[model samples]
Target: MITLDLTLPDTRYPIHIGHGLLDQVELILPHLRIPQVAIITNDVVAPLYLQRLTQQLEKHGVRTIPVVLPDGEEHKNWQTLNLIFDALLAANAERKTTLIALGGGVIGDMTGFAAACYQRGAPFIQIPTTLLAQVDSSVGGKTAINHPLGKNMIGAFYQPQLVVADMDLLATLPERELSAGIAEIIKYGLLGDIDFLGWLEANMDKLRARDPVALQYAVRRSCEMKAEIVGQDEKEQGVRALLNLGHTFGHAIEAGLGYGKWLHGEAVGAGMVLAAAASQAMGWLTADDVARVQALIAAAGLPIRSPDFGAAEWLRHMGHDKKVESGVIRFVLLQQLGQAVIQPGLPATLLESLFHSPHIDPALARQ
Candidate 1:
């Protein structure tokens, strides 16, 4: 088992990445303020992991409350979030009651938000079951539910007590979901780690084949990069925003497609491609660089082309992005592969031209 520490200015927590972590109750025992926990998951993940986790905790004499929510990005809203509150209130959960997120990003976000809001604040733990969650969402402490206006517009920077990223859990992850997770891993490489990026390029096939060694290295490296950035700027005051590499455009795609239509990672895949193309247009990257970005995304089994939302509609959806400041949308663009920059006040004509740019146009990209 490999452990990485996220040492923030205020607090520090351990992110445990390895096989069979769920079976290790001692790891979770130390983090719980009380002997009680509320395991928040979804219908899909519950059948697979909820019972096993519950059994492991219960054997240690910890009281466990299972709160199963509906799965999907579309359900990440007020109504769904309220379900957690209902379970907590009914169970007489208190500030000491640790909320354990046992599913993927959705479950983790909602549970963390619940813990933050419950009795003003409560401790929480993240046992992220998906690749995307383990490598990115589970480590960062950025918790949110999707708003119709924009993805993750309503959320908080609430950190967890501990994060358990059990590689064994990923064995059941669907191929599409696995590919989605790789998108974020690729993001870490693209944003700051050129060596890791090259490694991914060489080992893409091994990663796709789910080689245990490759998976562990990818997860560890991705977590290390995120932990470093997040430690420096926990609230996204500066460098942390670079982590959003493709998120501004990706969030627009999620909102434009009405949520859940395209998996977050898939949207990010195409979004990164668009960002790369934009960089080329700005003279930061060459045409070959953009092609390389697109090729990597395609190799990951993600979409390289975005759905055509038209210029006006695209702008409308992106206008609500959390990165927008003073009505100017800040973009996390690349100055070069492995170096990201946050820039605002892009020219209206430049955006108009990008809308018609081959990278943004699905039909044109295919041709």
Candidate 2:
């Protein structure tokens, strides 16, 4: 087990990454303010993990309330959030009742938001079951549900008491979902670590094969990078925004496609390619650099081509991005393969040209 601490200005939490963590109830025991917890999951994850987690906690004399929600990004909304409230209220849950998210990103986000709103505030823990969650969403405190106007527009930065990223849980993850997780891991490398990026390039095959050693190293390194950035700017006042390298465009894809159409990581995969092309246009990256980005994304089994939503429609959707300031949409663009910069007030013509650019076309990217 590799344990790392995410130290914030006021508080810190331990991120436990290993196999068989779910069996170690003692890890969770210390973080609980009370002996009761609400395990929030989805229908898909509940059958696989909810019962086992519940059994483990119950054996320790902890009361468990399982709230199973519908799965999918489309269901992440007011109606679905209220389901958690209903379960908690019926069970007489209180501020001391810790909410344990036992699924992937959706479950974690809703559970954290529920805890934050429940009785003004309550403690929560994250047991992220998906790769994307473990590497990114689970570490950072950014929790949210998708809004029709924007993805994650309505949400809060509510840190968890602890994060348990059990590698064993990923054994059941579907291939598509596994590929989705790799997108975020690749993001960490692309945004900052050149050596890690090279490592990923060399080990993409091993990662695809689900080699345990490679998985552990990837998760640990991704968590370390996120922890460092988040600790420095917990509220995204500065450096933290760099973490959204592909998110501004990615979020627009999610919302414009009506949510759940493309998995978040898949959208991010294509979005990163678009960002790379935009960088090329600005003379920050060469065409070869953009091709490398596209190659890596395709190698990971993710889409390199973004849907042609047209520039006007694209802007309409992206206008709701959280990174916008003073009505100017801020983009996290690449200055180089291993570096990122936040830029605003990009030329309208430049954006329009990229919108119609062959670089974003599926046929060209595929070729």
Q: Which regions of candidate 2 fall more than 4 Å away from where they truly are? A: 361-367
lDDT of 1 by residue, 1-367 (tens): 9999999999999999999999998999988888999999999999998899999999999999999999988988989999999999999988899999998888888888888889988999999999999999989789888888889888889999999999999999999999999999999989998889899999999998999999999999999999999999999999999988988888888888788888899889989998887788788989888888888999999998887788898899889988889999999888999898888957788788888876666553222
CA RMSD of each candidate after superposition? 1.9, 2.0
TM-scores for every candidate against the unseen true structure: 0.98, 0.98
TM-score, structure 2 vs. true = 0.98
Q: Which candidate gets the maximum lDDT versus the true structure?
A: 2
C-alpha displacement of 31 in model 1, angstroms?
1.0
Enumerate residue pairs that collide in model 1. none
**Poorest 10 consecutive residues of model 2 by lDDT?**
358-367
Query: Can you give the lDDT of residue 220 in candidate 2?
Result: 96
lDDT of 2 at 271: 90
Q: Candidate 2 lDDT, tens digit per residue, 10-127?
A: 8999999999999999999999998999999999999999989999999999999999999988988989999999999999998899999988888889898888899998999999
Per-prediction count of colliding residue pairs? 0, 0
